[model samples]
Target: MGDVRVIEVKQSVFAENDRRADALRAELKAHGTFLLNLMSSPGSGKTTTLAATFKALRGRLNMAVMEADIDSDVDARAMDELGVRAIQLHTGGMCHLDADMTAQGLRGLEALATPDAPIDLAILENVGNLVCPAEFDTGASANAMILSVPEGDDKALKYPLMFEVCDVVLINKIDVLPYFDFNLERCRERILMRNPHAKIFPICAKTGEGIEPWADWLVASVRAWQA
Candidate 1:
């Protein structure tokens, strides 16, 4: 055995992360909380859409949010003003927030929930990366990925995994559709090919067009899961 030197590679990059995420899911399930992990490219209006969504769901259901980013808690601060329990997770230098990070974030949010009324909906605004974030589960009951018109419809083909795992595909910034070259038909065709079961919702987060249907679908989805 010439010099017999070997380095033990016992750790998985995502192993610990997945374990923590599974636990988080169990905890939320026990409380009957439905988790929605929102994914999208930076500036795709995911955070803004979340704010609008929370506004629409506030009185109707017990809601909370865990917003994750590489830096700055601005998104969390923005949601807090809307009167729902919300917290921010700074991923430090991590490009994508995994299960462990989300678990801690959810803990902070749990404290924000009312004592008598447990959380019904907990939306995780995943770190704004259209790629790596889609690989991890984050213990979300469903993954909702937003694709804006500015990003173009060809995105579904380029990032099939993201579209494949998504529970819903939201076409944001539709009001500006006329100004851009986004092809709606091509977008839907690609998404359906990746995930036929994924429900599609088109909306302009800035103008609030087609948001009600998305919100309604969300509310109904939560109720269905809870029931």
Candidate 2:
């Protein structure tokens, strides 16, 4: 019988992607741009939260948004209406954006940016799915995810990797906590168990409740990255 060889395709792919992600991070640092990778499940109000964030930091920072989706320019259009340099990235049915795809999106954003006002904060709204996005490094300065109250508190337990990779977790739709069975404290505990260093903010993206802290964190992060 002939000898069989084993190949670790997934491991090799991840290692290569990680190397590219690190290079991308260095490039972004040289350009003085802070990239944030935002993730969430579909219908998690990711866009609405971004709208609130834009409103909070509009004049304070030169910002741009790269909306990644399987297919759709709707989010990009919405962001454009908000007056930011917005670009839609079609992932061609892929559930996530790797470092190379994120770098390509950054180039597109660079073309849209003006000379006088370069992008200080570039946000990549990653494809809406917890599993695939968590497995790929997008070379973002930080990773954030939105977990709405309706999604329940046990999400951290089910999607441990998603919680572990996130630097911040926004508990959105807190206004409806009364109607939902979600426990804010328990959710925080679960998230902390998965990632002890994660900063959590319970917010209502619809009414702009509890957005100040989240926005403040972003402002600090951007400034720290640039400094």
Candidate 3:
């Protein structure tokens, strides 16, 4: 042993993030706001699915949206066009949003909200990197991910963390399943291995085939969050 002292690092960098996430959750709950953090790979049909979801749930609840990306305000503008309050957050170059970033985004969204039009549900469309987004908690009341048929059934295996952390999983573009070699049963099995209780739904967002049930489940979830 030389004349030097050694220090041990016992806490993880994620520890602080997780702690802040818990606090954000409590704050959101106090306001009766249910924040849903949505994640997926690029081109997962999140926008189309979200559009259908808004159509189904509109006028049933007070809703808002926060679209996060490295650049561009396109999605936020699109959501605003749907008659819902929307905000776009630019990460500058970061790939994921930690609890603090999410809180800041929510604050911006809140400023646009009004007492006559309070938000009961807020959906945060996170940056489109399954791996990075899944590694951080955003204090959402629920977490969900969309997996398109083109992405293949193997995604659940390759991106286990995404499936593991999500409370809900939507298999979008089911109408195109016949054109692909995707195995629905196998994919379900793989996801169940990571999260046995995940509520999985198959939907054709463009065709509006499965939007009603999804919207119903989501509405129930938002109300339950308040309770």
Which ten-residue region of model 2 has the weakest summed lDDT? 70-79
> For residues 1-227, could you state the per-residue lDDT of candidate 3 as single tens digits?
77898899899999999999999999999999999999998898988888899988878988888888856334666777776787877776899988998999999988999888878999999999989999999999999999999999989889989999999999999999999999999989988998999999999999998889889988899889888
Best by lDDT: 2
Model 1 scores worst on lDDT over the 10 consecutive residues at 70-79
Give me the runs in candidate 1 sitting further than 4 Å from their true place: 1-16, 70-78
By TM-score, the best candidate is 3
Provide the global lDDT of candidate 2 against the true structure: 0.91
lDDT of each candidate versus the true structure: 0.84, 0.91, 0.89
Two-way TM-score contest, 1 vs 2, winner: 2
Winner by TM-score between candidate 3 and candidate 1: 3
- In the range 1-227, model 1's lDDT, one tens digit per residue, is 58888999999887877787888888878878999998999888987788778777778888888778745434555676776777778788777778877888888888887778788888888878888998887988889989999999999889989999899999999988899988898889989999999899999887888889999998898888787
Q: Give candidate 1's root-mean-square deviation (CA, Å).
A: 2.5
